[model samples]
Target: MPAPVRTAAQWAQFGRDHVSHGLGRMQDLVVVKGEGLDIYTSDGQKLLDFTAGIGVTNLGHCHPAVTAAVQNQVGSLVHMQCSIMFHAPYLQLIERLLPVMPHPSLDQFFFWNSGSEAIEAALKLARKATGRPNVVVFQGAYHGRTYGSGALTRSKPIYTQSTGPLMPGVYTTAYPYWHSLGVPPSTSEEEIVRLAKHQLDMLFRQQVATKDVAAIFIEPVQGEGGYVPCPAPFMNHLRELCDKHGVLLVIDEVQTGFFRTGSYFSVNHIKGFRPDIMIYAKGIANGFPLSGIVSNKEIMATLDVGSLGGTYAGNAVACAAGVAVQDVFASEDIGGNVNARAEQLYNALYALRDSPKTAPLVAQVRGQGLMAAIEFRMPNDPLTHEGLDKGTHIPSNIGKRVQEFCLSKGLVVLTTSCFDTIRFIPALVVSEEQMDKAMKIFTEAVQNVANEG
Candidate 1:
């Protein structure tokens, strides 16, 4: 017998009753289907999905090629435990990934279930390969939420609040976020990089010594940390520092991989840049539960044979989807689309920043490729002009207000970091027309919020 159909409100109520309260939701709308650049609500309203399932749907929801690959794989094999045997999809996915990797030196791969698990695996590999006990991370970094990755996440205290005694042997240094450092937006990138380097030096001298540090984990563009891209000079400096101290450099590409940043990987933006280990997940398989770390054969070989296998790590279906994702990347000009859409997004955001009504609230606009953000500062905030009343009182949660406004008008966006910053993570395949529409909705939302303030 068929179950009774429930209205969207009923479904939402049921979810609120049964789902864990800790799992936050941006909206109560019951999403029934997603295609291309839009999500369909249970009540039949369509919304422009600017969040892209939090950067996991880079190729867009249920891309036809990926969908076909997954369907075929599911019919053949769903879950082939990695420890039991090798699978065709797993091997094929690696074959597809090799040529597109940021560097040829990252020749080895280990599949995992999530970005957090991949991060854990990378940390273990780094510790084993280097025989070091400590790991270094930057301030405002968001690797993941699992214990090991949580220990390294410094973007917000709420992530670690009440979670006690996180994985030990983790130290933090400053990332080149001038806003977090209370510096003006005009602060030179070189100065910020210099300050960050000096802090890392201090961490080595005062906290963990270079010899004991196993790896330094970083995001090419900090995702949960206000969409701030690490300066190329700082990235090169980290590479140099890692070389000087034998510290493995782990680039967390969870949110920035798979052409999200107008390249195969965000690290590609830096000249002659290569990471000791690259952690990938998010959009690797569109929306599938797949992630992995790629390192050199030497580093991977340091771990024992039985050290890294997970029961469902390299699920055949997920691997099939991953292979298909790479196939799409090879055949399509997704990277080109990302760059074009990113330019459109930035132009719109910069226009908002320059507008008289929104200028006071627009603290900063920063990002790379389509991974963009607009941070809001209250009128009296130090980041903006103090004592400048813009006719109305600006709320502290202005980002949330803007998000709500967008959602109410059939757009879905997300907030990031500890600041009042809204992130924009549209699918890489979003068309020019779709981007214009999204920008139109987003511009109206910001303008409305600014007016309300």
Candidate 2:
């Protein structure tokens, strides 16, 4: 969103009066239009976008091919009872997605309207297939907001406040925070690996039987819970554990798929790992409402006919958009572009890490490909060691402030996890020229905010 002369406050007030108060607004910016990786505010200010509409819009806002596909599909058949009746556009997109999937065994897909719905469907499918009610997830993981997905998201208290008496038999355990947990993330890969397996073991021993656990839900690179890349060895071990336990491993790839992580999925990047079920959305349709839960034939077939369907499931326009986006990745160096932009973005963040601007608050820079996070540290107070690393207070504030600084300077970032961190999920099409421009503006904002301190 561009900054108008009247700025965010003026438009914000108008919106508070006119617009519905239900949708959550971030940073108080009013974006009116977008092109490529840049968004223009109602005030006519242009900011380099790092957050691609919360990981949507990976092909960037309104790519011409996707736009044309959507327009063409809308003209043909915009909506259909895809389950009861067949639609060519839907079938075509599904066919396109099959080969790109991690497992050909998981060729069967159930398209939904959003990530949450896809997750909910996966949960239900797993439970039905296994004849089990219990499921497991990590402490810092996020799935989505539907009842089942919400039950597994253990990151934020606010999401659960007064809401939970959520689905029963959903269990959780300490996810590996190897570096912070005295396990040297690199040198103690052995220990880290042991801890992840142990945590799941503890969950099973205390909460649910190994056989009773239907699925182990995970995000390869956790999005809302901070962009924490699940360790490779740990992930491989998890695959083994699931096999031994006869538990399905369901991965939520809503945020990391579609070249966002330099591959179709983080799972594909990690060797010896494949989920029995995987949820994908966000960039799947280039900002359109289309998501899916794809699972192995054995698991997906457990659902009786007509058990799941949606008014907009396999929506023609969205599916066409998805197919076009897939074409872009298949033809262009979109994956390489994401990886290249990721390096540029990471390098920019690191260059600022030691700068007086970001250093005082900087904790760590972590990510894979274009999905990255900047975690802020609790400012150590010598007068009171008690304040250092205090429970979720200091970091969250710093994160918010950093978001404000970025927003003020025409850069968009998102707050995530239980930390003081901002996520960077720019479009896979972000250019080197635009990145250079963004870096300079971002540095200026951080420096200005630092000087204020």
Candidate 3:
């Protein structure tokens, strides 16, 4: 017999009783179905989804091409242990992705089930390849939640609060945040770049030696770290540092991959920046659970034949979806859409950022392509006024308030990166009409929160 569907009250009670408390949900949304850029709730309300499942649903929810590919593959085959046999979908996906990769030498691939798994694989590869003991990452970076990735993650304390003694040999350094360094608002981008390089030098001098570091992991567009795009100068400098020290540079493109940004990958935006090993996930399969890394044969060969093989790695259904996603990206001119819509969002958001009504609470509006954010300053934040530290600093609370207001107004948004920035990562298929509607709701929500303050 088929299982019976539960009513809203029953489902709520079941979730309360059965779901693990470790999982954090943004809003009280029990979605029944999704299509395109909208999700239908159990209460029968259609919400314009701007979160895109935290940057997973790049081609939009249940894209027809992806759905058809998955359905077709599920009938023929689903699980194929990669170590035991070769599968067509997996092979096809690799063929589809290779042409669009930023670098010509990033030809080899290794598949995994999630971003965290891919990260762990890359960590092993780095250590094995370089014969080094330590790895370096940045503050405010969010890699993943596994013990290995969590050690590299610095976005939030709650992620590793009681999880004792995370993987050792992981070092953290300051990323370039011009606003947080207490630098003058008038500081030019060149000055900010110099400050960032100085901080990095200080880290190498004080904390971990560059020679001992096996790899320096970077998210070219810091996703959970406030949608802050790494300046090209910094990326070039990092490349130079890695070359000088023989440390491999690993780029984590989990959240920024598959046309979420205007490019096929965020690394393309940073001129001449390339990684020794690059991790991929989230948008690769348009919500399907699949991730992998790309590297040259020389770097990938560090992992012995038996070292990387999961039972469900490169599952046929997910790989089929990935192939379809690539096809859609090619035929649809998705990059063009992202550039146009990103401009629309940035203009509307900057207007709100500069508005006399909302300017006080707005710290910065920054993004590239469709991955964007409007950071909120705490009530007593220094940027809000020349001199103030009064009252409890609650930018996170303010972000939550704006998120809740958007939810009530029939839009689904999210808070990310230090818990103060309202992140907007809509689907690649989001239409111009939808963009106008979302911005209208978002502007009003910000105004409402400002009024409350």
Candidate 1: deviation at residue 264, Å?
Answer: 0.3
Name the best candidate (by lDDT): 1
**Deviating ranges (above 4 Å) for candidate 2:** 1-11, 18-22, 178-189, 355-358, 380-396
TM-score winner between candidates 2 and 3: 3
Q: lDDT, candidate 2, residue 84? A: 70
In order, the Cα lDDT scores of the candidates are: 0.90, 0.80, 0.87
lDDT of 1 by residue, 41-63 (tens): 99889999999999999999989
Q: Poorest 10 consecutive residues of model 1 by lDDT?
A: 383-392
In candidate 2 the C-alpha lDDT for residue 296 amounts to: 79
The residue-by-residue lDDT of candidate 2 on 1-453, one tens digit each, is: 885565567888878888876566785668888888888887678888877888899988879999999899888887887867888878888888988888667788888889889988988898999999889888788887767788888888666668768898888876666532444323355676677778777777777888888988988888877798888887787788899989998888999998889988889897646789999999999989999998877787789988888888888888888889888888898888887888998998898776754665566778999899877664442221222343423322667776777777777877888766778888889899878877787777666656666
Error of 1 at 210 (Å): 0.6
* Prediction 2 TM-score vs. true: 0.91
Best by TM-score: 1
Model 2, global lDDT? 0.80
Model 2 lDDT-worst window of ten:
381-390
